[model samples]
Target: MDLKVDPEEMDCNQPVPVEVFASRSTLHGLSHILTYERICIKRCLWILFFMGSLSFLVCVCVDRVQFYFEYPHVTKLDEVSAPVMIFPAITVCNLNSFRFRSVTRNDLYHAGELLALLNRRYEIRDPHLVEESVMETLKFKADFHNFKPRPFNMFEFYDRTGHDIKDMLLACHYRGMECGAENFDVVSHRLSETHNLILASSHAGEP
Candidate 1:
């Protein structure tokens, strides 16, 4: 069989391996052999060096291949017993964070508007550009400038703006028994800056 390489869908081209290899190959010894320089011992040494290097490379490849399939531990299913499951706390926060109906007009105008504006401070160019209702809120009906804010009460403020657990739980039963807001604990949410309230199942210790 002819060893000459064939070009795809083109004329078959025969490349002289010895001549091409000598010209293009990076190997130093092969060129010397091609040039016919009378150094028999040097040629022998190059051959032995290449054979030994090939053997070493092959051994390294085989070793790595053998180690590739090796695992630290075998994977197998094992049965394990787990007892005493604790009830998880589910946080129930109001979709509408601030309840306008619960909050007083004055508080909504002064503190509520302030809170709303504070959230959108970076986004708004002018306070006048804000919603007409919000602008009207800032502008007092009796007096334009005079706006008195109430005393800061953490619990009271949260109670006014945030939703109550009692209002949410119309009907709830824990383990076939009647349950109410008393079963849950009131907690401040992170998103509300600890000013708004959220309901969570009180840790009763049993699931």
Candidate 2:
């Protein structure tokens, strides 16, 4: 038998071989290998998902156990009635003025009464501790937050004098006002509002 092959149909004047055709015909076998590879990938994904879920459940369980174990102590503390005194706000120009006679009269009276109550309640006799308690009580006054009207520079004063009592006092006064207006009461009120709204929304969402 004679076979006729066209030159135009050949690559570089050589006819295409049967082995090359056979190789091309068997290329579909690679698809089966790919299907097995996909199955392996799916199995690996399932294993990873199961492990992640298990780890998350374990963490939740540990947190629940810790929270419950601390609940009894928290409840006991909540039951104890502590003495609390509410003081009216004092409006003062500065801390130095606050230490004076005219500006802090009502504040001083309430403060002294609160101190006596605290001393009777806690039986604390130390002078330094008593002084600290008096200061802490005074801090509760509403006008405490409104006095320091501006921010004073500390870094500049420290740079100039090495240490300046007057500058530091001014900074403290400024900070107290800032705390009242910007840091303490305003933020606390906002936070409380936000928390209450969130809680209300959550309760609404629940049954």
Candidate 3:
């Protein structure tokens, strides 16, 4: 038997092969998978970035909190007393070193004794002069009585040579002391005189 082919009917109803349909379906599924993978990768990157930023912020906050806790805030006038010693025997290289070694009560007493000796040697008769000299010796600037209490770190004043006496004297002037410069000169002279007297006395005693 002979089979007859109809061109018009074949053209009107062209049947797609199963393989081609499967291939098209596979391509569409592959495209969806690729899109999903890209989205997932982008999401993962964003999450990682966010986590890193959060960790950095947390670390900064913790550091700040630790600093705040370690150093108590100064808010009272009594808390801001005069420096015990204007010139320490040992020098501090930095503020951190000064913080580690603060002034003690014994240091304050020694400073007071030195001030008393200076007063006696200088023959300072005026009460105000005596008070001013004491304050200056303790690194307390003039008008300290009226100074507003605020958070202060004495270590900030420490230079490589522990505490610079010249700087402290300058601070005294800036803080409203009228005779800071003169006082410094007078105290320096008196200290020199006292040193000479001690040496002379020691020599006499040896004889």
Q: Top lDDT: which candidate number?
A: 1
Assess every candidate by TM-score: 0.37, 0.19, 0.20
lDDT tens digits, residues 1-207, model 1? Answer: 877645652443555567567867797556755645687887788778877878998999999888887845778999876675344434555666666455554554445445564233222236666777655544443232465755665456656677667776677655566656666766554336433332343446422
Best-to-worst ranking by lDDT = 1, 3, 2
Give the TM-score comparing model 1 with the true structure, all chains together.
Answer: 0.37
**Model 2 accuracy (lDDT, Cα):** 0.38
Q: Top model by TM-score, which number?
A: 1
For candidate 2, the 10 contiguous residues with the lowest summed lDDT are 190-199
lDDT of 2 at 91: 23
Displacement of residue 42 (Cα, Å) in model 2 is 0.4
> Which regions of candidate 2 fall more than 4 Å away from where they truly are?
1-38, 72-207
List model 3 lDDT by residue over 87-163, tens digit each: 21221121222221343333323232343422333332344655553544444322234445444333232322143
Query: How well does candidate 3 score on lDDT at residue 139?
Result: 48
Candidates in order have lDDT scores of 0.57, 0.38, 0.39
Which regions in candidate 1 have their CA more than 4 angstroms from the true location? 1-91, 117-147, 153-155, 189-207
Give the better candidate number (1 or 3) by lDDT.
Answer: 1
What's model 2's lDDT at 141? Answer: 38
